[model samples]
Target chain A: MPDEQARRIVLASRPHGEPTAENFRLETVPVPQPGAGQLLLRTRYLSLDPYMRGRMSAAKSYAKPVEVGDVMTGEVVAEVVASDRPDYKAGDLVTAPLGWQTHGLSDGKGLRRVDASSAPITTALGVLGMPGFTAYAGLREIGRPKEGETVVVAAASGPVGSMVGQLARKAGARAVGIAGGPEKCAFVRDELGFDAAVDHRAHDFAEQLGAACPKGIDVYFENVGGAVWQAVLPLLNDFARVPVCGLVSQYNLAGPPEGPDNLPTTMAAVLRKRLTLRGYIIFDFAGLFPDFLRDVTPAVRDGSIKYREDVVDGLENAPEAFMGMLKGRNFGKLLVKVAG
Target chain B: MPDEQARRIVLASRPHGEPTAENFRLETVPVPQPGAGQLLLRTRYLSLDPYMRGRMSAAKSYAKPVEVGDVMTGEVVAEVVASDRPDYKAGDLVTAPLGWQTHGLSDGKGLRRVDASSAPITTALGVLGMPGFTAYAGLREIGRPKEGETVVVAAASGPVGSMVGQLARKAGARAVGIAGGPEKCAFVRDELGFDAAVDHRAHDFAEQLGAACPKGIDVYFENVGGAVWQAVLPLLNDFARVPVCGLVSQYNLAGPPEGPDNLPTTMAAVLRKRLTLRGYIIFDFAGLFPDFLRDVTPAVRDGSIKYREDVVDGLENAPEAFMGMLKGRNFGKLLVKVAG
Candidate 1:
């Protein structure tokens, strides 16, 4: 009675620099049936993040790269259609790593149940999800900003940066956000309640950043890493802590950046200032997830922690949305509404 | 009467690159008098270290630069010649920041009493002083190498590096030492008891480092930067800790290093490997000095912890000794014997 074909996107080729639509290919395949002890899932929404750019390249990173012709890996909110396992049943919602596909089969491992009545189900892929947890764990572990200290983050309107600013403000620290344009900057300052927002695209971005934080930055939640990092480096105070979560701007780089080499200067500053720079992924702090949900969910429900989503309709638009998101074209948490 | 025309080295000029003899001027001035609450100290041994190179430059660092025509700043093992302070009297030995002068007046501030019978008084300058404390605090607070983990340090035969390796070994970690030549390398491996010693002068230095660190480096006590860092960067394991105490190699660097800019690569690795890099100076952990003395004094007295000194005679030879130390020509702790 229902259509047997299911749609999916696969990695067609690796890009040399910025990724393009051609690097991904859409295909139709038979919707997989649930085997013994497995559950059938129909995708509701697929989340696109900067980390996906790393998976496309054939280079060694924290995680393995997505091979050519394999379905591009991603997190998705899905509805359980049928279940062979006793724990899950029909019409139940869950968040699973089912990737860029309309339907998939899950073995019940790594699937987190989503309670629809608590909040919007889409929030699972944004505010209460990996991005929020990344900000939380990184700040708690590395960037322990004291009250009145300044905390800075780029991509201020994006999920991780938005949460980072909110958390920093909650900790009684001054929060500064850096975004590309006026509208996002306005949202970061007015809507997100960051102490100040700087436009990175401005001619005097570094000077503006300096003006925003007169005390100098104490905690910098580093997501976007190219020019923003260059601006932030000199502004970092002695004993500053940098929780390096992602280098979204650098994910697409093909080779080393243009000179004058900044490594020596960066290392020298790290030494002279007694700064601490630590790299981390959300999974590294998975043990803290229960604590993360305990703290963040109530704030989300009470409207104290706000989140925004730029959701594109249909699975076919995922490639364009992802490419545009890489260029920071999306205003908030970028997601693809794969199905109703 | 003893010579009233006391001699000291003054900063004649700042060096653009490597410091030359012309940059220092030996001057004769009337011996300073100790007023009430002051102690006059006669210079016994003047410590020469790589940090002096930084003081010779106009560039801002952790400590203030020595201004032109001022006595060049250094620590000295001094004998209390005359005392107006109740706590100190004539012939009492003390460690003082009395610069390069033959005689200096102290207001009793920052003068730590040296128990002449406890250990060699010069140990107050090398093994039991700032250099020794640097290795202890850095390794304890930042490095924290676990049992069986590997620790790497450069300037292997120097005070800091030698102590770092021994401390790492004490902590049950494999200690790898990097030095310039065969003699220093031999001293590091055979005498200092580092698990492995790699010659930075070897044609295949990086390969040798890699071979020595079969499990990869877990903790790196960064005393020397530049090529050693380039070698250590890739070999760093996931969650590797880098305690940056000094950058001896780049102390005289005038400009950014030659490109293909290494910043992006370094930052990328930092994120992907989840590395932790922290910089610190000894004073930052001065509170741990008592604990350091408690742990180290016994080891030194028992001959379990050993040290070497490359002592040069005369205050006039300090300039040459200091210059040679910067170029790694000095085999051990570089000091000038100002008087018996």
Candidate 2:
């Protein structure tokens, strides 16, 4: 019963625009003892993603909005401290959707025991987890980057985009990455080995993207669908494929921007260029998860694929870190280290 | 030989706006004799398709712009008047890229010998040919209409739209058809088996379209993308697929339309609803031809597919008919009858 204390963050209210710390509250409750076929978890890390902002809004989305006062939904890398489940035992590290909790009890279903012997436990959340799978599935399944083709991904230093750019390059396609600032751009270019990295906040971002992509963008891994889409769309080649995985840019908007609306022009361009814009959730292609892990996990081990993690310590800092993430303050994949 | 005389229509001048008959010239010329391995073709039917207007203008397109003073290009059903090639004999009915001419000589290439037995040979230029292929491939490939889903096609009485509307119905979806006038709308509703047909020219066309489909449209087969698109965009369901095949309504404009530009609004909807908008030329999906023939030709045989032809007699009148067709003056597939 020493594993009875569960420290967790819960949604207090849906934020109208940018999330504030007041929207989330940290509390402690007695963690239930594992019953038959269950495992007791000591949460070590909570994977914070941009997509969490979507769950904090009342807007309809591919995933269900997190209910009020429930633990803020997320995947966690945890150590199994105790177990009534025969499948797992103490000292076994595993990945589970344990939300923002410091300790959790699992039914032993949907838990995958990680082999820390193969790689460090943190890699499970960064390169080998949801973020990595997102990049793999979106790039291969929707992006379908052809050899010698140019693939452009926004938020290049972020986990999904970092992998998307790298994986596209691995497939023999030229990868152009777009990040927020010069430093992140340099990191993506130098660290992740992206072919070109442009800063979206630069004075000549559109021109820089144009100059970098002389052959025109063949695949645009669209994670940010506001000005980035506006910039990337005109530069798209006649047969470009845009895999719409997330619209992180629009996650904070209360409503549509005021406009001399350009919807018709977008439709016109889509018609003329024969562009393919497809929206997808990661699990929509869950049938490919086995293939995703098999292909991406080893690429991480050999350093052929690289990743960066921006760890914001403690559950209380989740809200502020997420808010800063919206403003492009964090570099790389943003994660909250809840407990050890 | 009588085959020595050739009657043809050529582009006289590029139209600054809607093409007038003055932009075309009808003339008689010496028909060169068929050389070795060549056949003299006497055009029986010249297909007056909307795409010809794009060729006449200096506008950039997927295909090369037709040179001014060149013979207007089109698909024609022709009769072999003389042949030196063993594959084709005189008096044989065939489909050829014969331009807008009464006579042509082919070296037995790019010509498909039509049996004139399966369906009317004219159909080779209409429902069973390029326009039909445009509809089938667009609807099946991009539209991906599910059973019980609502599908919409504009210019619904035209060769392409009529086929799209009918095929959507055959796929077990509800088809909503939009046409310019009451007559065309009636034909689309009655003969084409659409669930509802709305007249685009109606004062309350958008309201009518909304009334027709209580559930929002799931797939919009975009052939005419002017005022109709304005109405269609608002009615699109979340995750709707818009296969933009043509912009017939905007073809005549010399420059982009002015005032109340709606591009931003469209992009916002695209992001908000996770909509997909793709443009494609028929040749992009030409690989589907054999399969298209297998599926659609059978529908034609059983009357599950129906087509209407607006046949204009005599090659000299082709220019006038074509001009009328652009104004939605001609109904269904516009064809010029050159010879019996």
Candidate 3:
């Protein structure tokens, strides 16, 4: 590796409300050499997820926040450019936590080999990876949607939400997908085969959601909170299970929003209706990853499970793409192409 | 049944905020004769619970609200007077939903024979009845407090909260009881054997509670939801289980409280800390009653579990006692001795 330079984005400062371009600083640096048992990885694709927003803030959360002047943390599909470890060789494709950098050095631990021949390498970052497993584990272990029961999910065109809808359908439950617009709603209904898809942007979004769930919601796979959560709360039936995986809608808010405080009301509903609201990160259910891949991979291969990617062309465009994804502007699984 | 008369209390009007004496009306009426397979019950004791407040209002809830001019609904320990059913005979002490009346004709379907010889018949109205079963099912099933985990319960002197604290101790978990005053707190600590007791009436109640649970709260048996809930919220550990049984504090509130709506903040905490907040009615777990009896009855008999009764002598004084209990004035399980 002859002194190759790597381009990366770092957290410049924490955002007050919505993150702006100034919050991120892009810089070029010489790629560091891999020591003993280390593999130098060249980033091919970086997965942009809702959880990345949480890592940008200095607030207390499930995981440690990325400090100012540190590479913005993310999962990446990368190629091994040089290897000091016997397990990996130059040109081998692997998936690792390579952050926002175009290159990374790994100690051969936590890096998993990916076969490009089996499926597109990008699928490892979306349908066959953390997001996919999150849907599987959260649905099976927490949501536990029964046949004929209604399962509602928001951000329905995103990686996790799309998988959640498809999986709910596979489990014989009625899948109601809530997306931001007509195109995404159509894709969610037509391509993803969700039982119904409602546009959250529509003036009658709550009404449409209510109409979609005729028997009331039994399992609500909560990904995007805020208005979607408010709409879903009243519809939750007795013993309704809510697996809260993310709150992408409120991730950028600096503090609590204006209210006729609904917390007490929510708690009241929880008691009267016997609702179960549980929050979880995917790592808590990491044991289910192998099972997830086994179940989801076959469905994807047979075209029973469909996925779409909204790939931004360059690493420099990640901040805008990420911000756009937060606002429901991205069409599908948001990814950044870090290498040409 | 030769023109036998019965004294009863009926709903005069729905309360707007706090129920006044005008909301209740005492009246006299002829007792109806028992039909085939039915028994005429003479009310001996009536259970006054927080849930009755919900029943007084026309608001939507788990159970239907009591209509105007109807007998105020309640669970009662009654004496079987005239039995047309083979299973029930005259002089049998049984527990049933006889409402707030001196005499009631039951089909003998839902009546359970009370073993007064084993434990006081009034115990059926409390520690061995609905409240006991609620604490059992919620703790064992939802709360699932592991050994050494700290379990916090509000309304510590009430029938439900008392059972919860004792049951948590039985499960090898540290029981932290929160009550209205220093007296109830002392009973919770000394008599109930709770590991720690905090007085909610104290100005530094939250601070005292924080000091009490050094390891943080793992399972919060939520019977009272207000300032106590607000205090407990921040102290809850990662993956904490909240078995929301009642919101006694908010039952009388005519509308949503003033806010900086903490709903979003609470939901964010649920997401970040991976907390499980579940609401439940005891009837939902009625199948566990026998198991509850087998587990708790012996504990009560062996003095491993202790219970206190705040027995109000007359049914006429019930309205005042019920209102007082709502304001945390009841020292123990609030029961009205409706008869001699």
| DockQ values per model | 0.85, 0.38, 0.85
Q: CA lDDT of each candidate?
A: 0.93, 0.86, 0.91
Once model 3 is optimally superposed onto the true structure by TM-score, how far is the C-alpha of residue A34 displaced, in angstroms?
A: 0.7
| Candidate 3 clashing pairs, residues 3+ apart or interchain | none
Report, to 2 decimal places, the DockQ of model 1.
Answer: 0.85
The candidate scoring highest on lDDT is 1
TM-score of model 2 (CA atoms): 0.86
Cα displacement (angstroms), candidate 1, residue A19, comes to 1.2
| Candidate 2 runs further than 4 Å off | A1-42, A67-71, A79-92, A101-110, A258-261, B1-40, B81-90, B140-150, B198-220, B226-242, B249-278, B294-302, B314-327
Docking class of 3: high
Pairs of residues at least 3 apart in sequence or in different chains that clash in candidate 1: none
Model 1 misplacement above 4 A: none
TM-score (C-alpha) between model 3 and the true structure: 0.99
Q: lDDT per residue, candidate 1, B194-245, as tens digits? A: 8999999999999999999999999989988888998999999999999998
| Model 1, docking class | high
